[model samples]
Target: MMERPVRKHVRLKHYDYNQNGGYFITICTRGRIPLFREGDRLSAAGMIARACAEEISNHFPEIVVDLYCIMPDHVHFLFMAVGTPYMASVRSNPTISKVVQQYKAAVSRRIGRPVWQRSFYDHIIRNPTDLEETRRYIAQNPLKRMNSNG
Candidate 1:
């Protein structure tokens, strides 16, 4: 039998119209923590996580943020890209992934520890079906968290 070449899962390459640049990203802490404690206030870790997400948005001007939810352990975001998808040309440009790296690095500096996982979970939203499903997931993540907390 002949051996097949191993393939890398190049994100946008797998999708049809990589130019349709809307992404919903989910980022989580290295260890899932109800980092917020004591009062009903966000803990130091929680604040750091939020700052990371905000930095990602600030760094990636191409990404237009539509919505976001900053939780104790993870962050959710919905954003659209203004130009070609990050993969279209790799155009010697800083893409969403690089922005995320910057966010993670800054956060690690703030905490004096590695805070985030290396890679994030992202999905390209195409039509109404995908959009609605993603929105619903983002909307209900809080309820899911509350249930888990209880």
Candidate 2:
């Protein structure tokens, strides 16, 4: 009988994800299929993904979508979790995983198909320098892709 390979755990152990902090996240399409770009422009699916990402803050008040870029097969974004008293009163604890899952689900529902891979990649922003670098990376991702493609 063949055995399945074990997937490595990607999240930081014992870290409080719901605490106030910034997170850099990357989510890719299933099979790394390029479904979000076309000739330097975003496809319909990409637009939906963008809209959904933008609405994440509305759905989860504790989260603020700082910056985001949608590429052909993946997306990169930075979000800040600023805890709200109202959220605490409501007994809602929003985390990075929950936010990403909701965003993916919204995009998939709007597109009428499953479009995301099982899990996402994340980096916890440790300081001002890291945050600035992450912002630059997200801002420059499209240009990098354009240069590489052209």
Per-candidate local distance difference test: 0.69, 0.91
Q: 31 in model 2: Cα distance from truth in Å?
A: 0.5
- Per-residue lDDT of 102 in model 2: 90
| TM-score, cand. 2 | 0.93
- Model 1 bad stretches (over 4 Å): 1-20, 36-40, 84-93
Candidate 1, after superposition: displacement of residue 56 in Å? 3.2
lDDT of 2 by residue, 33-106 (tens): 99998878889999998899889988988888899999999999899998753353565458789999999999
lDDT of 1 by residue, 1-150 (tens): 999888556466655433446678877887765453334466787687666667665776666677677777677888666655455456523466765677778877887888675578788887889888888888887778778878
Q: List runs of model 2 lying over 4 Å from the truth.
A: 85-92
